[model samples]
Target: MYVCICNAVKEKDFRGAARRCSGGDAEQVYATMGKVPQCGQCLEDAEDILFEERQLCTRLPAANACQGLRGLAPA
Candidate 1:
C-alpha cells in the first residue's frame, strides 16, 4: 500500500524505516528514508504503521526469551 504518494513511499518502506530508526517516530523514520511528509494526509497512516512495526520488533525478543525460559523451567 502506498503511504505517501508524493514521495513514492510504500507502507512497507515506512515500516522498515521505522524499525531501523529509533523512537519509531514517523517523522524521524521519514527523515531516515530521505523524505518528509508533504501533504500530511499520510501522516496518521504512517504513524499507525510505524507503531505496529515497532510493536512487532519490540515483542519478538521478549517472546523468544519467554520460550527459552519455558524450556529451562520444565526439565
Candidate 2:
C-alpha cells in the first residue's frame, strides 16, 4: 500500500492528503505531504489514487463527503 516509497507515503496517507488537496493534483498531493516524487516510479499510481479519491469525493453525499472513502472499490 506504499504509494510513494521515496517518501514512505502509504495509500491511506495519500488518500487523506488527496481529500485535503484542492485540485486533486498528484504534485499537489506530494506537496501537501511535504515530499516529492524522487524516482518518478510512483507518479502514475499516485495520480490514479488521487483521481479515484477525487471521484469518490464528488460522488458521495455532502454530509458524508470526504469523511473516508472506505469499502468502495475503484471503478
Task: Tell me the TM-score of each prediction against the true structure.
Answer: 0.75, 0.79
lDDT of 2 by residue, 1-75 (tens): 899888999999998887766563688779978998899999899889877886776677473546544443433
Off by over 4 Å in 2: 61-75
Q: Which residue ranges in model 1 land beyond 4 Å of their true spot? A: 62-75
* Overall local distance difference test of candidate 1: 0.67
lDDT tens readout by residue for model 1, 1-75: 899999999887776676566453577779988998899899888877766665565567455322212212110
Query: What's the TM for model 1?
Result: 0.75
Model 1 deviation from native, Cα RMSD in Å: 9.2
The alpha-carbon deviation from the true structure for residue 55 of candidate 2, after best TM-score superposition, in angstroms, is 1.0
Report how far residue 23 has shifted in candidate 1, in Å: 1.7
